[model samples]
Target: MVDIPVELPAGPETVTGDWTVGDREDIVLIAHGAGAGKDHPFLVGLADALGAEGLSTLRFNFPYVEKGRRMPGPAAHAIATWNAVVAWARTQEPSARVWATGKSYGGRMASMAVAEGLVVDGLAYLGYPLHAPGKPEKPRAEHLPVIATPQLFIEGTNDPFIQPLEQFETVVSTCQNARVAWVDGGGHSFEVKGQKRPAAEIGASFARVIAEFIRG
Candidate 1:
């Protein structure tokens, strides 16, 4: 196993990420969400699980967050950053199948990149924000159906970012190679009230699901 940090080129922002390379010929590259960086405990936990499964994992931060911005950077910049990271990961394991994975906003941007013809073996979305909370009409799924790469979306039943399960189902149904996993009683952050589980455990659970999906 190897942990390496690489630089991200996005103007004045210098972003770095942690990577663990296993002896396998498959890799999963993960990007953090809008409100956090690569060191987020959830990501760290998922990385641990993936490492144990013998699949390499790379987790990175976007330009905005690297610059200390709370909000996400523009779509063009996010896609560009992801492209750079993907390219770097390819250099690390040229023989490995490269899969893109992310949480929330990061996942959405990965979809956008796929739509724009960025090659990848698959995609895994930890919590896809199908639509903004209480704003179901403003969907963030126009490009999802067009992305042909095998995709997995793990969602929480109580997530406020996506509502009306029927709508999300409809979107997933249209995809040729898309699957969904429901985390019972969890919210957008995968926090289940009264369940009292640590974030790391929840993330590890989802990581196991992703490992299974990739293995299949």
Candidate 2:
């Protein structure tokens, strides 16, 4: 894994990322959720698993996480960070196809960036927070229909953020290229009910599912 520090266009602060190289010409750029950094165990495990499947991986922290804050910064900053890291990743491997994937908040920001003209081959959401917990009335999916790139949402069956599978289905149906994979009995983090597993194991388990989507 190579350490990469990305400098924002409008600021002096640099966000850190870990680049796990693979033999193939595809790369998955991953970002953390609101509460965690790039080095979180789940991300590390996912990166490793992707690497083993011959897909390079780049996992990075958003600006707020880099600044030691628990709450995420504005969407603009997060999108800028995504842009910077993606730009940097292209420089490292210009021939590789870059795709974006992230947990909850990170995934949402990636979608927003793509909606606002950031280019990517595709997108994968680990656990898309479709709405605030317990409030499905306000779904954050207005941008879903406008995005033309392929999308894969790996959501848990019991994730409160996207309760009532019908709501999520409706959103996906409007997209040009979108699909959803339900994790049976799992929560927002893909943790299954009454099933205890290490963070790494849980993260790695989804590698095959994501790889298949990317390969298609």
Candidate 3:
């Protein structure tokens, strides 16, 4: 476990993280989505799988989640947390390559941070919310094209957040280096209708694809 300090407008806050050491030279720093924290089974399973794959994993919470808030504090705060976590990770194993990834909101924040010049080798999004469901008029993609690092988008074919796949495809097309891995018939959390599976199991399933993307 680690405590990462983030300076928010209100005051300085500390976020918590769990580091699972692996036998590899690459370090994957993961952030939680809007709802969950570092310990969620979904994230835990992913980290555990990464460990088995010999990839170091560090899962951490944003400032808001650390403070027990249901909603994210602010994009700036989340970005600061990303900055802190990445810096901390680099310090721990300066020779290790660092990659950033997270579920939905957490992953989006990472892109924003990278766009704003937070250094990271690459990024992977578990599920990117292209737009609010049914409202593709506005997109949160302006900064994506500016990011030069390799990016991997693991999206579910049936996720409402990216409803109207064509628009999402266009956004990806603009990226400097990005690719998508679609989950056939899966939902936002990779939940396939009529198929019952624990969140951890579902999360763990994505490990191989994500690991491949990282090493690619």
Top TM-score hit: 3
TM-score of each: 0.93, 0.95, 0.97
**lDDT of candidate 3 over 1-216, digit per residue (tens):** 878787777888888999888854899998888888888888999999988899999999997777788998779999999999999888888988999999999999999999999999999999998888888998899999999999999999999889889999999999999999999998889899999999999989988988898787
Residue 9 miss distance in model 1 (angstroms): 10
Q: How accurate is candidate 3 locally (lDDT)?
A: 0.90
Q: Please count the clashing residue pairs in each candidate, in the order shown.
A: 0, 0, 0
lDDT of 1: 0.84
Q: Regarding TM-score, does 1 or 3 come out ahead?
A: 3
lDDT of 1 at 31: 86
- Candidate 1 lDDT by residue in tens digits, 138-176: 889889889889999999989988888888899899888
**Poorly placed runs, candidate 2 (over 4 Å):** 1-10
* Residue pairs with clashing backbones, model 2: none
lDDT, candidate 1, at 145: 84
lDDT scores of the candidates, listed in order: 0.84, 0.88, 0.90
Which model, 1 or 3, shows the larger lDDT?
3
Q: What's the CA error at residue 9 for candidate 3, in Å?
A: 3.2
Clashing pairs in 3: none
Looking at model 1, the pairs that clash are none
